[model samples]
Target chain A: MNRIILGVDPGSRATGYGLIAATGESLLHLESGFIALPAQLSHSQRLARIYQRLESLISRYNPEALAVEAVFLAHNVQSALKLGQVRGVVLLAAGQADIPVFEYSPLTLKKAIVGYGQATKTQVLLMVENLLGLTLNNHNTADALALSLCHHFHSRWPQRSVSPAAI
Target chain B: MNRIILGVDPGSRATGYGLIAATGESLLHLESGFIALPAQLSHSQRLARIYQRLESLISRYNPEALAVEAVFLAHNVQSALKLGQVRGVVLLAAGQADIPVFEYSPLTLKKAIVGYGQATKTQVLLMVENLLGLTLNNHNTADALALSLCHHFHSRWPQRSVSPAAI
Candidate 1:
């Protein structure tokens, strides 16, 4: 059995999740995708769909641990609230599986993958592909993989990591 | 045989729920609770357990509608994120039952029951008890009732209300 890890970039509009497994030397990507819930649905309806999708992903991947992106709220209050709700679903999925969850910030993930804390999304995605030896065009999928890679590297070198999601 | 309304005041640490029904010109309080989960659990774990409990509550209460507090943020980003997750569970619970969810805010509820939008937490609690004619202290329970009342009133007179959780 492989030691699998699930990384989630949680958001209300589109939540991206990636599953990866690390061998003694390198990491292998198993699956990655984003769940897009309609914005028009009552917020509750949207959340239900998200929870359902997240649960299915967990069962399908059966990861040993989950690494989700910490909720990032820049300034917009409404956006931040929605993000919190999305993170809730991410955590709920891990909890249901009785798996320990580790949280990573977007910046931390970028720094780990691209060697800079200020790397852009596109830059991080390109570096992730280079590191994984795969050319991925899908931004969400690439971002998810980057998050997974970051978690793997962070787990290996705790001293190089930042304060991940509290929990 | 009553128009029971279930109100939920979701939080990262405790999810407060209340049930009530309108009787002619009065409102009668029913069962309520604080779904307390340890903060040690990862966000996902907390949310999963919350979902299970909320699902049971919805099944038992069979509320006609659900009123949930919207996302409230004030400088504290992590708190907002946690609150968002709980609020999402509230949304998911209401949605799975195909129950229409009504949104409310602290200010609107406080003003409706206490006649002051800026009422302190203590004032709001006192007003909720007086408005609902409760003889005992159920502080969290009262918050739920207030959310329900605010929603009920808004549904009746949409023009006269401002819902905080409108999203």
Candidate 2:
């Protein structure tokens, strides 16, 4: 069976998205990029831009599911609130398109990609590049791709328990 | 000139919305109600519901602007994040419909409605009822109405300096 998945790393200032197609035991990278919102735009305008861009991407990719990193403990209340606002629109776009969403925590993503829950971002990025045979310079895009791959693995092995916390 | 305004008090579980028309010096209440989301719904589903309901209201009332309470210091990080999620969809609906949004802090709302920034909730509600000549039992609905009235007053007197903090 072939499944196309879209992974999103949403932020207030920038949002990264990656698409991957999983066929049997092979994973193929389709597209990956990030949207950098203009600093001049108001908070509301930034959200509208994100929504419109995500909707366009969903339409173009026709992905069956959206994979995103689950919310963990944030640094502060203000940052958490800002992150939540971005996530709200991202989820709304998926809901409007009737796409199922799956969340993987940072620990799960690291374990799935780098064989260790506490692996560094560099390690995860290296493993993702090696597994997908593509060079990714942007950390956000690499993280998004890792999320898509994590979802793919989880879907294949439903019995595997990926703990939210570090193992 | 007459203008219609939509006031929104967004929450994760329940969202309140009120509409009023401002003509000359009179404020006429158009509608006020709250959307009570089922507890069983997922967080994403809750956001979708809020967005859809707000869109319907906008389409029905054709409000010239959306008035909402600004983000203040929240009780905690988790609650702040949840509140931001609700506010996200609310702002998106207004943005998608091209309705201008104006944010007023709680202090501003209270002062505009009750002539005192430090007025209690009961006092604000009473003043809202008196100003609009209607009874409001729901606190969320009353707050939404208060926001609408604040915008009305702010529009009429653009020179008024409404501080974010209490007097």
Candidate 3:
């Protein structure tokens, strides 16, 4: 059976999304990219754009599941709040489409993709490129793809089949 | 001309909203209430519920503008981030309907409602009741109504007419 999973890396100004189709032990990279909002738009306008774009993408791809990063500590509380806002919009879009969302921490995602929780961004990017056999143009997209792989690995792990709490 | 404005008090679990019509320096309350989500629902489900409820409210009232409180200091960074998330959903709903959003800080809202920025919750609630001539059952609804009144007062003040950025 083929299961399609979408991975999301949410940001206040830019959001990255990736699609992967998995069947049995095989996985194929479908699409990966980022949405960058206009600089002149207000925060609300940017969120609106994210919602609209994600809605359209979901309609087109019809993924079976979604994987997203959990909120983590940021240098500034304000930035963390903004990131959370973006994540909210991303979750809303997936919910509207009835897609089940799964969240992974940065450490878990890195470990799943690169075999180490403390792997650097460059290391993770290289591993994602090798695993998916695709060159990534953006770091955010690479992270999103890694999230998709993390979900795939977690789902297959005998003890972790049960999905974690959403959000 | 009858100008209608919608005010929103965004919350992760329960969101409050109010509608008011203004014409020739007169303000009349139209509707006010809150939407509470079940604790069992996932984060995305909660956000989706907020979006749908807000969209329905907008469609019913056809408000010309939306006023929402700006994100401010919370007891914890997690709470602030959650508030920002709810605010994002609120903004997305308003943006989808093409309604211009106006934001007011908590201090500004309190001052507009109770004639002082440091007014207590009971004081603001009483002033909201007296100003709009309606008994408010929920403090969140009262705050939402106060936000509407704030927009009205601020718009008329030549020095405060400039709208704040929507986030």
Candidate 4:
């Protein structure tokens, strides 16, 4: 059976999202984009918009699972708090849809995409494009696609005994 | 006309909530308590529980407005981020019900409840009990009540030209 996965990189001002379908050994990208929220709106207003937009995506894509980037150790406390709020909204959306949600740390995502935990953003982006056979406009979208790819890689070998061969 | 307002003191582990009804100059306390989420659950699961519980509270009280404590400067970035996540969940609940939400800083809440912005938690709790004619078992519920009271005081003088004359 084919499995569809939706990945998200949540941010207060903008949220990146990507969807992919995995069937046996092949992975196909279905959609990739970012949701840019207006800066002038209130925090709650921004969350409401995010909730609605994400809900629409869930309904449209009907992904069997959701994956999101875990919160990193941010230097700015305020920004970190804002990012957490965005993440909460995203989780709530996925929860409402009854989709199982997974999280991948930034380090793990980079390792999956570029064969190195401390890979540069450009290196990760290029690797994602090469793997998915498509060029992405923004790093946010690229990161989301990378998250989906990481999930695909991890889910294949549940035991973690050996890594799946490269796609 | 009578107006019911719900107040929330959002926390990652324990979310405090209070409901009050206002009819003209008189204020009546309806309900007050906290939702304690076990630490073992995943972040999304905890948020889902919070969303469901808060949504139920909104339905039970049928509040016309929702009041929440604004984000405060925290020494720990992770704690602040988690608090923001809880706050976002609270906001999503209110938004889902189409209830107007109001926010008050910790300083403003203390000032509204205890007549001093620098009041101690015990002092605020005592003042809340005196004002509402009930003893609160904990500081969390007191803080939530304080938030609701602050909204009541602020809404009276919509101009915010002058703070409400000592309740």
Worst 10 residues of 4 chain A by lDDT: A158-167
True contacts kept of each: 0.73, 0.55, 0.66, 0.61
lDDT at residue A144 of model 2 (Cα atoms)? 87
Clash-forming residue pairs, model 4: none
Model 4 residue runs over 4 Å out of place are: A161-167, B161-167
Sort order, DockQ high to low = 3, 1, 2, 4
Q: What tens digits encode model 2's per-residue C-alpha lDDT throughout B52-151? A: 9889989999998888898767778877878877888888888788877888988888878999999999998898899999998988899898898898
Q: Where does candidate 2 chain B have its weakest 10-residue lDDT segment?
A: B158-167
Among these predictions, the greatest DockQ belongs to: 3
Ranking the candidates on TM-score from highest down gives 3, 2, 4, 1
Local accuracy of candidate 4 as per-residue lDDT tens digits, A1-167: 78888888887768889898999888899999998887666566778888888899899989977888766587787777778778888888877777777778788889888999999999988998998899887988988888888888888888753232110
In CAPRI terms, model 1 is classed as medium
Pairs clashing within candidate 1: A91-B44, A92-B44
lDDT of 4 by residue, B87-149 (tens): 788887887778778877778888788889899999988988998899888878888888888
Question: What's the lDDT for all of these models?
Answer: 0.75, 0.85, 0.85, 0.81
Give per-residue CA lDDT, model 3, range B23-88, as digits (tens): 877889999999998988888889889999999999999998899887656666777678777878
Clashing pairs in 2: none
Task: Pick out the ten consecutive residues of candidate 3 chain A with the lowest summed lDDT.
Answer: A158-167
> How far off is each candidate at the interface, as Cα RMSD in Å?
2.0, 5.7, 1.8, 7.6
DockQ of each candidate's interface versus the true one?
A: 0.62, 0.48, 0.68, 0.46
Summarize candidate 1's per-residue lDDT along B1-167 as a digit string, tens digits: 46788888886667778788876567788777777888676566678878898788889878889887654654676566667778777787787898888776667777777788898877877767777776536566667777887776666656775433355
Prediction 3 TM-score vs. true: 0.96
What are the TM-scores, per candidate, against the unseen true structure? Answer: 0.87, 0.93, 0.96, 0.90
